[model samples]
Target chain A: MHLLAIDWIFLLEKLILIVIIISISLGVAMYSTWWERKVAAWIQDRIGPNRAGPLGLLQPLADGLKLFMKEEIFPASSNKILFLLGPCLAMLTAMMTSAVVPWASHLHIAGRDVPLQIADVNIGILYVFGVVSMGVYGVMIGGWASNNKFSLMAAVRGASQIISYELAMGLALIALVLHTGSLSLGVIVEQQAHQGYWNIVLQPLGFLIFFVCALAECNRTPFDLSEAESELNFGYHQEYSSMKLGFYLFAEYVNMFISSVIMATLYFGGYHIPFIHIADPNFAALAGFIFLFAKTAAFITVFMWIRWTVPRFRYDQLMNLGWKGLIPLALINLLITAVVILLHTQH
Target chain B: MNVTQILFWLLSALTVFSALVVITRKNPVYSVLWLIITFISISGHYILLNAQFLAVVNVIVYAGAIMVLFLFVIMLMNLNADAEPQKNKWLQFAGVIAGGCLALVIIAALKNVDAKARIAETGSDIGLIENLGKVLFTQYVLPFEISSVLFLSAMVGAVVIGKKN
Candidate 1:
């Protein structure tokens, strides 16, 4: 009964924080689409999308408006309900991971200290993994509901690809968990921040495995066989149009943004501003938030850069890399970590 | 009612409703989706018991991975209502009778239990990852290792079955 006591201020704070985080995620996702195009253009030696506003800043807005205005199409053969459920689920799973991510250390407001995260759940990393796994259903159901052969095929490929990469991703995470000895993202980040040495320095191989898995998990290029335009003819979202299609596309960008944030938080000393020390608590919180955003932005840029630079892998090659290459490598890394910890403890 | 009691009743109701839907759905795909809802409601019950690790793992393993595989197989087989053959009337009658008898037997077996004495306070931290990990590695280490070996054998069996002729 004591645990069930309701605190109105705490509830209100969480509600407001949730709203802010959701809006921030949506805003970052919107800009990521613009940034992706800009990066692609720059890499190819072309000025990209400079028409909507200064340096094509308003292009995502234009794209959003166009998608909203487009005709909504539901094929005659398609399952009406599940087709709609697809993008909604996609958007949901994309946003859900943000709940556990510690955006900054802590902000003191009105004589009260507030944690910047929505929920510091005990099993934060597992929650993220669960939500990410659920993300496959959105693509799977949407493609199947379309009632098209190619769409179904694409859905199957997407589901299998996600499952395959997830094993390696979990293995990579286990290695890091062994080093940190915690499942809570906040605890992991705080440990790194206190020590001033990120997990990346100690777990370089684990980070590389994790980075590859993140690319596959987000369905970025070199791993985006599900939506290969040349082969599958627009793939899973082919039958979707208007806002439905926009949601699926938007969800992809949001997933990218979240994964980039996850990468920064898990390995790159999240919100840990290095080489500069601040004594003031309030100032440190703001600086930490900015530093985390900068790291996430850098990761997002790398995601886009690789998307443009690397060619799409053949399906077999993708499977081989995930199952044979990354999984075994991650296992070896975990074994090495365990042995090192054992030796150090004995000494 | 207390918050915990209210949440327990709500989640139980959802689980029952979804389980009913799972059994009654005409489409296998819809049935799978309803089963996922059932799993999610059960996970909510686990969370209510403060087993956060089990709650998340239940969703990841059952609703996420297993259900996705079920959906993939259903799609691959193109299983539709039209493809399902109707059972004979006598067989259907026997199924209902058998199910009712099983339910009666279970109820009879549990009728003697003291339910009120078994009720305990919730929000225990024993279900947290750290506590559970310690218990599993220290006290249940042999069983854990045995289960992993079982999984390895199952995997090898699957590979053998899946090999091309």
Candidate 2:
């Protein structure tokens, strides 16, 4: 008699999980800025952001408010719609990537077993790459809409860099996909948890190439040629102000967080620490979330450390590393992996 | 109609709308962006048919990489609505004739396609990667490898030409 039979409970569960994950991602990205400053301060022998709150914990909140309160400027010569579209697109793509990532094992709550993920789609890896590639529009449209030459230059650089690294990144990911034989992130993580060793043990070179590509992808230091202050003058977001600029900056951190989570999922055994077994399923799920969180935190710290430690790469060097170095290295690793898999199967 | 039908109609409208915008836009950057939207909506249609692999690959390759290069070239040229070159009347007439001929050909080609005769394929797994991969590697491996060789040669040609220039 009903028009449509619906699983309302399932719908409600997903809604709650969505809210929680979004909050966690935003919260983590906010704190990551604090952590980055603290790391930078530590490196330079200075105490950072003690005045904002305890350990400058509220600095991000302060920053957010300042951004919100700031005046918004639409350039007289700029395309108004695209200028606004840029930041929103960036933020949207950043948030969309979390949809395919399996955050943890199944959770037993409200008398129903709920997965701690949004959508564990079959083409999860491709979905991530597609959404990430879409992220270039944020920079491209934003910079172009600024009607500034430097902004245009930055956008062009960013678009090219992202396009190049995505090649190497896809090549690197192919080796892992070949090893796992599944594009689903959930399935890959489950395989790693059940297997004795993580994929990193089998594919270290793939991990390295993937890591470098990730740095380039996120526009992080050393690979951040598009945002080179000396040459491009703050790069793509140069004309963006108010909350729009904040969104661009926030999207970058979210991207970094997501990439680290992806690396952990693909290489590190995600939530599974080998030989440490927990009998209770619910507790195991909770522990898995914690483990995944800890790994991402470690990765974020490493990202920050690299940002402070390494000097930015020259444009040509960056291109050379991606094209000549990582691409060839990834190709070799892929070949080796194929041979190994083939040999093992013959036995 | 149900949700699937509703989604089909919605995506069809979106695809047509975006495609029209792509052609009509004065600014090439905006045109490219609209074309990207058109491709995305087409990908949505692929997903509606449960062709997950094709849907994602379309987005990753066509909408992501190819469209970005188009956008890059257009943006670097600093072209705008005001800068768009005017076309000649006879050239425009010839262009219209060509496009109309293409539309006619496509329509004639698809006129024999009768979908209603076949059973509605609900929950078909043929579009899934596992099935696609098996069929492709086993039955269509020769063509697949040949296309890849074609792509490799194209890549080499591009690199060689760029180096020489």
Candidate 3:
């Protein structure tokens, strides 16, 4: 309402959230690489990056430093303007989407209660999806600008794959919206405050479709035709290296983290725990924040687990699942949900 | 003006600017990008409306999915500015005249509107979906039911167009 504004207090709060989310995303993206290596090693019965630091935990740090120290090379024939813009855009958009996610319930700082989110806009989910969608441009622009056939091809695949999967993903989310009857993610989580029951219980099909689309959207393997190393030799990022390449790589993890958090918020009842109720306005907000992060971490583990387990899909098969399978199923799910809601209201 | 009102004006200006860019940009790719900026700005407007549901749906459907498809098409076409046919002179003339008339009409309409209309202050707590549902099913039941049919027809239309060889 008229109460909403970019006032100093609100601006300060938003800035803090941005700073926190960006730092966490960067840190997680780095650690996730090590985590992926360790997880892969454990699965394959081999030692991971154990030499960098105890269990190679500092490996990401070492890798990051190497990227910074490496020479900055611009391809001779590339569109230099767009080339520079691509990775920056990629990293920026990935970091930007996390702004709306309800990270905590609420915080009571300086005797004033504030929501632990940057902006509790009515369309939190849509905003997340919008920002996430913008990410493809970074890949597409980067790939095209590289002027490398390999990069262009990879970008094409990335674009196509994202387009196909997103339909299914959006449809799946529609069913959830129908169930939760709200688009504000903060409100959605609040409805599930009693931890015992979550949207996953009622919308399992939606969850499955959502998770699959998330994997594809994040460009993880099995759906990562865009970056099939065996075929494309690093895909859209073929011409990228050093920090530019690091941006592309890190952005993927940041997206994975954000998507995982979104999934947790949607299905697992973000930051909601039962019996330990904090009805006090200030305390409830704080509790909500903790619940959100915990839920997000759990979903992140699931993302890692699936990445390790699944084999990359054939490009055609991936399209088929997205367009032919999931989309239609999601539509059917929405129909069924509508009918159920109608019947429930009647009763 | 208070911070929220100042912020709202900034966001609204950005939205309008991006929307204009969406239409005016010469590069197809840049046009798509501008449209995305428009989408994000509109989402900002939704947040302002406290209709968070509509805002998210707007992003998910328009910015997230549809815009991606538009980008994919533009990329597939691999269009360059020079590759595009130059605008016809008469068409440009007509467009300018029409645009001028449209701008004049908008300004005239705005002039007649009450400048100090009471700004409806809806709280953030009333979630969009529940309120939308109540309004949709009760006050707007007929229109809501009709819209479902319209959506169904649109779905059919999409399938028909997409399926054509």
Candidate 4:
């Protein structure tokens, strides 16, 4: 009976950690808008959104409020329930991916150890894949419920594109999984931190394939074929107005932010301080959090930079690149990794 | 009730409810969405059984990939309530008879099992990736490879059928 008792302290710690993590994700996603605009402006030789606050820091807030204040236009022909469920689903799935991600090293406080992550589920990476795959429903439902042809077309494109890229992404990850021999993100990060050799050294080719597939998954340029403005007109979220549209947009930024964290955590050594060791556990954990944040920020900057740098891929080109280019490359990388690991183990 | 028992009951109700909704929904898209919900609740059941790998992969494969493709086809078909073909009352009666027979078979099949067998209560490492992978690769290797080959053949058959001269 005593063994059946619940750990209230564990639940409380996880609850607090979840709240803190989601807020940080939201804040980062908000500022990611500002950062994207700044990057886009920089590339185009223009000052971007300097009006809202200093360095346009408060622009995301103003933009969010503006979206909130705008009229919500629900189409007469739309399926009301599914239409509303669409954006909510998008936001929910986007936030759900963060549950397994280890944000930093374990913190020691008041003679108790606290981990930054919410749920370090056993099948961490697979759980992320499951949630990420479910993201397509938001686009699909939003488009289908709108009862608009353009929206339907965009949704079909978005759905297929995600499905295609996920294969390459999964294949790319198989190599890393084989190398690490574990699926837990915390364990993976801990290994990288202690070993001082990031998975990137052995997984550069896989990382490149992963990076391209990630771009496709995020629906950023040059893989932004689903929302091609020249043809699909406002894309899957076309008929959405006000905060509904805002949810769709915010979900994209949230996804981008989360993917940045995932890439940093996977390829780079997440939260690992390069060439430095701190004695105090609490201070080290704090430093690790900042380090992971900086790496994630770097990845986010690269995402935005590429978005502005490359033109959108043609629909056929996007499919070809996903199915033809990246998948085979990832497969070859997997084989090479397998052989290397085999030889190393035999020695 | 224990946490495991409570969660098991909740998930079972959700699965049954959503599965019923899936069959009852007039709109094809709604039916597909409800089916996804059914699959997800089943995945929850897997989680409750401490089959973490099975649970997430169920979500990834069934609810995520297969259901998306199902929804995609239904969406593209532009099906409506008006488009649904009317079923004869006798056909419905026949379906009920068929379903009852299936249920009878299942119940009779399970009658020999221990009724008090613990499922969700025990946190078993048998479902963990390491153990599952080891067993699957060794003892069940033949079946695993055969299923993979079957999938490959099916895929190849699809491509061949889909190709135009």
Instruction: Please provide TM-scores computed only on chain A for all of the candidate models, following their numbering.
Output: 0.98, 0.98, 0.94, 0.98
| Candidate no. 3 TM-score | 0.84
A23: Cα error in model 1, Å: 0.5
**To one decimal place, how large is model 4's interface RMSD in Å?**
1.4
Best by lDDT: 1
Model 3, residue B140: C-alpha shift (Å): 4.4
DockQ of each: 0.77, 0.73, 0.44, 0.76
Q: In model 1, what is the error at residue A305, expressed in angstroms?
A: 0.6
Better of 1 and 4 by DockQ: 1
* Candidate 4: regions farther than 4 A off: A1-4, B111-114, B117-121
iRMS of every model, one decimal? 1.6, 1.2, 3.4, 1.4
lDDT of 1 by residue, A1-347 (tens): 13467677888899999999999999999999999999999999999999998888999999999999999999999999999999999999999999999998888788989999999997999999999999999999999999999999898998999999999999999989988888899999999988889999999999999999999999899899999989999989989999999999999999999999999999999988878888877888999999999999999999999999999999999999998899999999999999999898898
Give the top-scoring candidate (DockQ).
1
Best by TM-score: 1
Q: Candidate 4 lDDT, tens digit per residue, A201-304?
A: 98999999999988888888888776888999989999999999999999899999999999999989988888999998889989999999999999999999
Candidate 4 chain A least-lDDT 10 residues: A1-10
Give the alpha carbon lDDT tens digit for every residue of A1-347 in model 2. Answer: 23545567777778998999999999999999999999999999999988888888899999999999999999898889999999999999998899988998888876778898899999999999999999999999998999999999998999899999999999999999999999999999999988888999999999999999999999999888888999999999999899999999999999999999999999998877678888877999999999999999999999999999999999999999999999999999999999999999999
lDDT of 2 at B10: 98
**Angstrom error at residue B99, model 3:** 5.3
What are the RMSD figures for all models against the true structure?
1.6, 1.6, 4.1, 1.8
State the C-alpha lDDT per candidate. 0.93, 0.92, 0.82, 0.91
Poorly placed runs, candidate 1 (over 4 Å):
A1-4
